[model samples]
Target: MRKKALKAAFPHTLPVMAGYLFLGIGFGILLESKGFSFLWAFFMSVIIYAGSMQYAGIDLLAAGASPLYTAMMTLIIQIRHLFYGLSLIEKYKSAGKKKPLLIHELTDETYSLVCSCEPPKDVDPSLFYLFISMLDHSYWIIGCTLGALLGSLFTFNTAGIDFVMTALFIVIFTNQWLEQKDHRPAVIGVACSAVCLVLFGPDRFIIPAMISIALILTVFRRSLEKEASDHEDP
Candidate 1:
């Protein structure tokens, strides 16, 4: 069962594997350039695992930011995961002992794949999701470790490497938009973000945009689900 689930999950994660590897390497290079060791890269990839937050953390660590500030920044940057968790509450509820790991490993790429992909008839859905998460996590760990080793061994230009993450996100968003018949969620997110961007400027808009997206999605959940189901029908 596990083997079958793994086979089914791997194809779905190929895109994520490519993205995470590049992004992870970029992160490692950036962190190493900041004077941290490869061990720091390996451990941070394992423990932190939040891509954007980890990138932000390089600066925080360099500046020796206060714990309170770190905690607040961590919350602000990662608060989107709260919404991701809410969406998966039902799908993951029956995962039993694996639920905790699933939640911990749920990065944006993992969430996008697991939320959209269904297991084969012969595969257990929970195991499929687990394998997907595990595979993606491993790719990131390996990539970060490799990058750190390379950084230690050689010198290379590191400018503009951080943009890898933004590029990955654009790919994921484009893929999701193409796959889903219901574009309301995407439209709502963009509209809210645009409005918030205009009202609050870039730095202050993130929280407000997320809040608006969550509330609007909640209020229209039933209708959106119904529309999604209708589109799925033959």
Candidate 2:
């Protein structure tokens, strides 16, 4: 079951593997540039498993941030995972022992892939999801480790490399938009985010945007579902 799940899950993760390798390398190189070694990258990648947070953490650690401050920062950055967990609650309820690992490894890439891709017939859904999570996690760890090793040997400017993360997210969003016929949720999210961005500014926008989006969706869940049903029927 595990081997079959691994094989079936590999193709689905190719895109994430590519993106994570590059992003992970960028993070590793950045950390290396800050005087940390490959060991730091490896451990952080393995433990944190949060690409963006790890990148941000390099600076925080460098600055000698307090533990309390670090905790708050991590919560703010990863607040989206709360929503991810909510969505997958039912799907993961019966995963037994694997449920803990699944939740721990639920990175954005893994969530997107698992939420969108179903396990093939004959493959256990839990195992397939586990493999997807594990594979993506491994790619990130390897990429960061390789990058740290290479960072010391090569010295090049890395000014715009961070943009790769942003680009990956845009690509993901675009793909999701294209795949879904009911654009209401997407439109609401984008519009609300834009309004919040303008109102709260970039530094303070995310929380408000998330709150507004959640509230709006919750309040109108019935209508939205009905509208979606109407669209499919029509």
Candidate 3:
């Protein structure tokens, strides 16, 4: 039974393991340098496993920050996942009683696999997908723990390591831009955020900007598409 589970998990596990190693190790090193311990890194990787969130977590945890502030900030950082999960609810619900747990494990890698794979009938694919998600998450935790322990003992400068999250976002943005024809929504996000930032200050602007951007995009989606069509015709 375990062997079958492992076999079913391999394809998805392979990509996640490969991508997360460098990322997790980098996060571990940064955490250690920032005065957090190996345990903190390991647990954060297992529980949070959120690359950008872990980066921000360092500062928040360091200051013994307020609950309201932490919740607000975490919401701003991770609200994108709400959109990702929304698109998956119907698809994931086919898993019956196990669906909620699977949804909880729905990281980027898992989502890609579930979306891309055409599972064999009678295979209980939701369970298979869950196995992959769990394995990849374990690999990430192991990598982070190893890196943090090694980092603490070795004592090296880890200044630029903080850029992992920034680089990750830039790559995501670039990929979206390359594939998307009508870039109006992306432009609107940037502009709305910019205006909100100027008005409300950085600490308080993200939620407002996100709400306004979502509303504006939905309201003007057809117009934006028409504008793009007109530009192409011209």
Best by TM-score: 2
lDDT of 1 by residue, 81-148 (tens): 88789889889988999998898899988998887788999887889999999999999998888878
Candidate 2, residues 135-159, lDDT tens digits: the string is: 9999999989988989666567756
Q: Against the correct fold, how does model 2 do in TM-score?
A: 0.89
Q: If both were scored by TM-score, which would come out higher, candidate 2 or candidate 3?
A: 2
TM-scores of all predicted structures: 0.86, 0.89, 0.65
Q: What shift in Å separates residue 199 of candidate 3 from its native position after superposition?
A: 14
lDDT of model 1 at residue 144? 86
What local lDDT score does residue 80 receive in model 3, on the 0 to 100 scale? 64
TM-score of 1: 0.86
Error of model 2, residue 212, in angstroms = 0.6
Clashing pairs in 1: none
Ranking by TM-score: 2, 1, 3
Candidate 3 weakest ten by summed lDDT: 161-170
- In candidate 1, where is summed lDDT lowest over 10 consecutive residues? 153-162
